[model samples]
Target chain A: METFQHSFPSRPLAWPADRSWALAGVVGSGNLEVLIEPNPAAPDAVAYDLQTSIPGYADSWKAALADFAAHYAVGGTRITLHDQGAAPVVITMRLRQALDLLTPAQP
Target chain B: MSRVPYHELKARERLAAIVDPGSFAEILPPPARVMSPYLPKLGIPVAFDDGLAIGRATIDGKPIYLAAQTGQFVGGSVGEVHSAKLVGLLKAAARDRLPCVLLIESGGVRLHEGSSGEIGIAEAIRAVFACRAAGAPVIAVIGSDIGAYGGMGILSACCDFRVMTEHGRLGISGPIVIEKWMGKAAYDSADRALVWKTSGGKTRYLLGDANALVNDDTAAVRAGIARLLGPASPVTLAAIEARQAELAARLEQFAAVTSPEAIWQARGVTDPAAATLDDAETFVASLAPAAP
Candidate 1:
C-alpha cells in the first residue's frame, strides 16, 4: 500500500450550510471511495490524503487530483480516498460524485 | 417507476433507502476517520466506514439505531473496528431504549484480523442481549445476496426479530465451506438452487426462524421493517423452553430427511414442485393452517 497527501491551489468553494461531509464509491477491486469534508483551515486549495493498495501510481494520482482541483470548485475541502487499484478515470468520477453529494441540489 | 432490489444496493444506499428520509445521522461517519489499523500493514485498502456503516436514524418517525455492512469489501467481514462500532451502537440502543436495526451482509469474521474479530463478535452478541433485556428491540434485516453467515448468523438469531427477503440467507457455515469440507457429493455448493433451498428465507420463514419475509424491493423491505417495529416481545424462560422443544421435535421429525424437497413435503408443503416456484408472498399465502 502507498500513502500520500497533497494540496492544490483552487478557487474558494461555497459549501452547503446544512452539510458537513459527503462520500462516494466503495473500496473494492477496481474501485475506490472518495470522502469529501469541509476544511475551513484551507480556503483556497483542495487537500488530498490518498491510500492505494497498488503502489507505483503516485504520479498518476497527483496529476488526476491536480486536474480535478483545477476544473472543480473543491477548494477548502479535504478529500480522502482509499483506492483498490481503481483506474484514473474511476478515481476522477468518484471525486465528482462525492462533490455532488456534498453540494446542495439545484432546482 | 421500477424499484431497486434491496439485495443489490450498497450498505449506505440500503441505509438511506430504508430509513426515514434525511433522518440518518452517522455516529462515526467516514469523516471521523475511525478506520481499520490492521489493513494498512497487510497491504489491503481500508474503507472509510470499516466496511460497516452505523449511525442513528428514524423509521416512520420513531428513533432507531441503524447499521449496514458492505458485502463488497472483504466480503463484509467483521474486523476489530467494525465489530466495535456494532457493539457501541447496540450498547447505545440499550441505554436509550431505542430499537437497533442491523442490515447484515457478512461472510463471517475477517480471517485477516484473526481472533480479534472473533472476540469482537462475541462481545457484540452480549450487547445484543443487553438490549433485549432492556426491552429495546434488536432487529436483523438479512436481504442481500451475501446474507448473514458465521458469527453474524448467530447474532441475527439473537435479535428480537428478523426481516428477510427471498434473496436473504441465514446460516452458520455457508454452502461453499460445507462443500469444501464434506465434498461435492455431500453438499454441492455449485448447486445454486440447493444452496438457496437449504438456508434461504423461504425455508427459514417456514421453519419459524425468520419472523417476516418480504419482496426484494427496498420499499417492501422498509415496510417490513416498519411493521416489526414498536414494542419488543419479552424474552422469557418459558419461551426458550418452548423453542427448545420445537427444535427437538423438528429435528426428530426430519432427522432422516436428505433432500430439501422431502423436508418441504414433511413440513406439509403438499405440492413441493409448485412451492419451489412460489415467491415469498405466494408461499406464505399458500401455507396450510396445519403446516406450523
Candidate 2:
C-alpha cells in the first residue's frame, strides 16, 4: 500500500452552492474511484490525496493529477482517490468523470 | 432458448434486471469511496462499494430498498464496511417502512478482516430484526452459485422470506469445510450431487426453510420478490410460539433420517431423483399438499 498527498495551484472554482460533494468510479481490479468535495481552507489550491494498492506509481499519479489541475478549474476542492492498479488512461477518465459530476450542468 | 445466467450477471446488471426500468437510484454508489480499509493492508484490492451495492428501486411501481453483493469481488465476503452498508440499508428500510431485498451470494465473513466482519454481520442481523419489527419485509434472494454460507446463511434464515434457486446452497459450513473436519468417508467435498442435496434449494424448500424456490432466471427471481413485497409476517408472541413448535416438530420428525431422499419421501416426493431433475414449476406442482 502507498499513500501520497499533494496540492496543485489552480484558479478559483465556481462551485454550485447546492452541491457539496460528488464521486465517480469503482475501486475494483484495474479500476479506481475519485471523490471530490469542497475544502474552503484551500480556495486557491486543489488538494489531492491518494491511497493505492500497487505502490511505486507515485510519479505516474502525480503527473496525471497535475495535468487535471492544470486543465480544470478545481480550486477549493479536496480530491481523494482509492486506486487498484488502474492504468493512466483510466485514472484520467475517472478524474474527469468525478469533475463532471461535481460541476453543475450548463443551461 | 438460452439466456444470460443470473449468476453470471454483474451486480449492476442484476440490479437492472430485478427492478423496474430506469427506476433504480444508487445511494452511495461506487464513487462514494466508502470502501474497506483492511483489504489494502493485506495486499488485497478494495472495491469502491466494499463488495456490496445498496440503493432504492421500485418493483411493479412499488418502492423498495435493494442490495446486491458482488461475488467476483473478494468472493462476495462481508467485511466491516460491507456489513455496515447492509445494516444501514436495512435500518433505512425500517425507518421508511419499505421492503428490503438482499441479492445474497457471499461465502460469509471476510477472513482477511477477521473479527470486524463477524461483528459487522452480527450488527446487520440485528438490523434485519429491526426491519421486521417495523413491519417492513426483509427478503433474501439466494440464487447465485456462490450461495450464502457461514454467518450469511444464518443471516438469511433470520429474514422474513427466502427466495432460492437450485444453483443456491445455504448452510453454516460449506462442503469443503465439513470434509476437512470429517474426512472423505464422512463427506466428500468433490461430490457435487451430495453437496447440493445437503444444502441445496430443493432440500431447504422441502424442509420449509426457504419460502420460495424459483428458476435460475432474473425474471423468475423478480417475480418471486414481487409476490413477497405485500406485507411482512407480523412477529408476535403467538407467531413465535407457532414457529418454535414447527421447528421442534421438524427436528423430531427428521432426527433419525440420514439421507436427503428420506426427507424428500416424507415430503411426498415419491421419486426424489425425478423431482431433482424437474424445473421449478414442475417440481412445485408435483409436491403433495402439506398436512395441516
DockQ of each: 0.88, 0.26
- Native contact fraction per model: 0.97, 0.41
Interface RMSD, in order shown: 0.5, 3.1
Candidate 2 lDDT by residue in tens digits, A1-107: 89899999977676552467776766667888787888889888999989888989889888889998988888889998878888999999998887777776722
Per-residue accuracy of model 2 over B68-152 as CA lDDT, tens digit each = 9987677789999999999999999999999999999889999889899999999999999999999999999998878999889
Instruction: Give candidate 2's TM-score.
Output: 0.76
Off by over 4 Å in 2: A1-107, B1-4, B288-292
The TM-score of the first chain in every model comes to 0.93, 0.92
Clashing pairs in 1: none
Two-chain DockQ for model 1:
0.88
Q: Poorest 10 consecutive residues of model 1 chain B by lDDT?
A: B283-292
